[model samples]
Target: MTAVETPELDAALAAAEARCARQGATLTPLRRQVLRLVLEAGQPVGAYTLLERLKERRGPAAPPTVYRALDFLLEQGLIHRLERLNAFLPCIGPEEEPCGHGCGHDHPHQFLICTRCGATAEIADHDVAHALTAAADRLGFRPSRATVEVEGICARCA
Candidate 1:
């Protein structure tokens, strides 16, 4: 199936290419292949699944290679680590735009994840951000990063 080309993905790919060039990392063909798979999948993809795709493309590959690529991608902020699912999905936001840290984005996005199908949708609403900040202020909890992921059945699944 053909993959949907969102504006976010286009921007992300361009940003990643620029970042790799600046860092002197080639973002080698294999790494690019794997990354494309993750991006095209449109859901959190497990390491083993990545390995399988890699093997299909290049004959044979070790698990460590896939893991290492994933690590590098995560480190570079090309993707985000989904803690709950223990899988990787491409970052849908602007490239090199830092969130959940000292980055200066007014509203960080939250993920609406579908447990059944692994579909993830981004929610970026001001009301939610305001409420979260207000609640955190009450508790005196300073949030460095604001990531609000709600995991449950999506409309289709429900």
Candidate 2:
């Protein structure tokens, strides 16, 4: 089976290339391969799964190689890591633009993970972020980064 359908994959790759150029970073071939695997996964995927897929296509891949690529992708804001799931998901922002929330990296986003189907929806709610920030400030805590993951059945599953 094809890992990803053609048109969407092509667009995503192109957009990634452009984003990298704008940020003065290079998305090398290896990194592109890793990104493709993540996008085609259609759900959060673990690092080992990515490595396994890479090994299937290439002869053998080192764990560090896969981890390095994942690091680069995360740094470029091209993907998100779901800490709870210990997996990665492609960022759901517009192909060529940031979410405009000024979240700095990966677009201050949250996930609605369906407990039953394991499907996830990415949402950026400024109010929620603001409220969290306000609460943190009240406690004299400074948050360098924030990720809010709400676990429940999505509309389809519900």
Candidate 3:
């Protein structure tokens, strides 16, 4: 909605394009547009909202079309599903190496979600990972996926 340009978003779009090329998949115009919208948002975006925008820009779109594109993006790790909010956000960094069951091999960065505005911010901290590892070791369990999400009001909202 804002015209601000973010370096992070530029990098993400480049990464997505590269990934699509490497996978021999064409990032169609519609798909590219949708991805751009999500990246520009800098927060979680609902599928229905994406659909509405797509319809406005492209004229007459179906939910299936948007969902299909989203599925493709997610599969390629270009986007991530925010399960708690039932929304989607563009992935910020390298694709996490998948950890099958619970071994902490591939983990998503922690998210600080703003309850008031529904904005999601990524939190990267080695200490938090270390603490989780230590706790898991004590329980004789290794986490395959490590995601930490904290929800509260953001400064502006507060």
Candidate 4:
């Protein structure tokens, strides 16, 4: 993976650390590093891809180590797993409000995935969420969570 060091990443890291502290979760060095990799990727990145990147920097990193870090990130809501792609994307850290990208730590996760370029964008649509909830409630079903993924060509590709 290409290296990324930017003010945005630094700010994100700081916010993530602060958020973890507030939640009583320890964002250890390894976990922080993993989060950095995810954020730098700027797209859905698979676990194995992350592992390879780690290996390039750390000499040798076991799969379990990477997996554990990923689990911690997910639990802390610092990153999200794209189920369809089996990949991960960093959460829009608390530094930004109103969930401009729809991947805020507390916002609903809906993704528009570009099948051609593999780019993905998170979107927030309250109407869609409300409609889905209403439809489910009519059937007496209560959903603990929901993720919507739409695959198509992105505007850039089009």
Candidate 5:
């Protein structure tokens, strides 16, 4: 199950809301609901799943509506889109990243994905970032995006 009732979750929401306010962005009720679902999911959640859940309460909502909310959440650094699963997960990190894209997508981070339970964690470390950059340098590559996902079992699942 997703982290249903935790202090960290509460803090995340509060921080997100505050950040949105600071930037003159609206974390609308609908967007907030979507963020909650993704966070409580305890794993990556697909757009379809989010749409399904929204329909249960709101009735006959369109995919674009959810996507728009998702995009807003992503821009505010409240959630992230998992590249591998094409799913969304909460941004559980402590600080904000530069917003060249006005979204956390520019943030260099790594994901530890639990293949067994589907639980995911986010990590932002300098060493790992350097290693990625160094490897890319070997090929004279300029990295644009740097979100990484590794599939394995988390300690809880293991």
Candidate 6:
């Protein structure tokens, strides 16, 4: 498995630290480990999954220990939470800012979820989101989030 924490990992970490600095937040050691685990997994992972992994390396890690870090990462947009799967995956690239409501978090994205190997990839189309949101406004419909998860087998699995 190609670990996501490869050479690109350094750039991601730097971007995250800069973003936190702007937001007056600190990337604690525990939070950094959580982010590393998610990225290294190269797939969506649940909090318990991370907790178990952490325990193997750092001894007994409580649920709260992992949860707190997950929460912080989510708030910073260093990671994305898949509502349907109740799991999290790292964003495609380094994020310079948090993805809050209206901060482009609603950017239309088709999350490709691979069932066989449990991998996930987010395909975002900013133009599509703009067009869809505009059309909705004309029809008097308000849309908040534009992310959609499409499930299927990945090429590797096939």
Candidate 6 per-residue C-alpha lDDT over 27-88 given as tens digits, one digit per residue, 9 for 90 to 100? 88788878888878877889899999999888988999998998888776677888878998
Per-model TM values vs. the true structure: 0.68, 0.90, 0.72, 0.90, 0.81, 0.78
**Winner of 4 and 5 under TM-score:** 4
Worst 10 residues of 6 by lDDT: 95-104
lDDT of candidate model 1 versus the reference: 0.71
Candidate 4 local lDDT, 63-101, one digit each (tens)? 999999999888777777889999998775435521344
**Top lDDT prediction, candidate number:** 4
Please provide, for model 2 over 7-36, each residue's C-alpha lDDT reduced to its tens digit, 9 standing for 90 to 100: 777777777777778899999999999988
- Give one digit per residue, the lDDT tens place, for model 1 in 31-68: 77777777777777899998998899888999999999
Deviating ranges (above 4 Å) for candidate 6? 92-106, 131-139
lDDT of 1 at 79: 65
- Least accurate 10 contiguous residues by lDDT in model 1: 98-107
Worst 10 residues of 4 by lDDT: 94-103
Q: 1-158, model 3: which lDDT tens digit per residue?
A: 12215575566566677767777887888788888877676678889999998888899999999999998887666667777888877663423221111212144467788888876776557689989989999999988767677899888789
lDDT for 78 (candidate 5): 74
CA RMSD of each candidate after superposition: 4.7, 2.8, 5.5, 2.8, 3.9, 3.7
RMSD in angstroms between candidate 6 and the native structure over all alpha carbons: 3.7
CA RMSD (A), model 2: 2.8
Measured with C-alpha atoms, the lDDT of residue 36 in candidate 2 is 89
Candidate 3's C-alpha runs over 4 A off are 1-11, 93-107, 130-144
Candidate 2 TM-score over all chains jointly: 0.90
lDDT at residue 62 of model 5 (Cα atoms): 96
